[model samples]
Target: MFEQIDCPEAQRLVEAGAQLVDVRGPDEFARGALPGAQNIPVQVMAQQAGQLEEHKPVVLYCASGARSTQAQMLLQQLGFPEVYNLGSIQKYYTC
Candidate 1:
């Protein structure tokens, strides 16, 4: 099952070299996003799954929790070992 982690834990994972992916659209991502976050909108996340590092954990977020949660499920279904939902980037920024 995929896990939902809070900002502090997400930050810790990122610090430990986890990949932070913004599952929002290109426009939403272009507006603003967490530093070091890569844009891979949920729609194309499956196709781009191979771009993710196999050894590192992957943290996903979007404008709201919905998209990221879906993305988490997709990653897990694709056999990704460590996939985490960080909810909204806005929430992360506030943390």
Candidate 2:
């Protein structure tokens, strides 16, 4: 899938108050993630859709790009206006 946002851009977004979501399992997220990110597995995002709001954009990531891509699509389908993929968890390391 086409990338909606790159790691650097995503980092900037995070710094600028954009919402960050770690779409990995809790154990993986507990290991580490971008600061201020919310941990919510992709498999449970649909049921937890209430936790998100459409007006504010959300930047999501996982161990790889795949799960975040799925999350972006699901969020969009759930009517989120702006959903961005921040790529893999590695991106958080250098940012």
Candidate 3:
């Protein structure tokens, strides 16, 4: 598994225009999410990847880093060069 990321680091990437995707379930995301982050749920990442914007830097996140990291790796295996896991949503979702 990948090391966890801090809120500050995640926020910096977001500020730099990373395409943040929330992989948490809909309920969790509905409660809160990083500003501008979209909820796609990790369970659907593989199938829904085509829906992602290819030109942007993709940053995935969940309640914890695990699912996002997994999603990131999956995307990478699928040839997504700009994918990364942004870690815990609680660490960054303030909006």
- TM-score of each candidate structure, all chains considered together: 0.94, 0.89, 0.82
* Candidate 1, superposed: residue stretches over 4 Å from native: none
Q: Which stretches of candidate 3 lie over 4 Å from their true place?
A: 1-5, 93-95
- Candidates' C-alpha lDDT: 0.90, 0.84, 0.79
User: Per the 3 Å backbone cut-off, how many clashing residue pairs does candidate 3 have?
Assistant: 0
| Between candidates 1 and 3, the lDDT winner | 1
Task: Return the TM-score for candidate 2, rounded to 2 decimals.
Answer: 0.89
Candidate closer to the true structure by TM-score (higher is better), 1 or 3: 1
Q: Is candidate 1 or candidate 2 better by lDDT?
A: 1
> Best candidate per lDDT, number?
1
- Candidate 2 structure quality by residue, lDDT tens digits, 1-95: 44857768887777887889999999998888777889879999999978876688799999978998999999988988878897787876764
Residue 20 of model 2 has an lDDT of 93
Ranking by lDDT: 1, 2, 3
Residue 55, model 3: lDDT of 69
Residue 63 lDDT in model 1? 86
Per residue, candidate 1 scores C-alpha lDDT tens digits across 1-95 of 55578999899999999999999999999999899999999999989988998668999999878999999999888888899999888778767
Give the clash count for each candidate. 0, 0, 0
Clashing pairs in 2: none
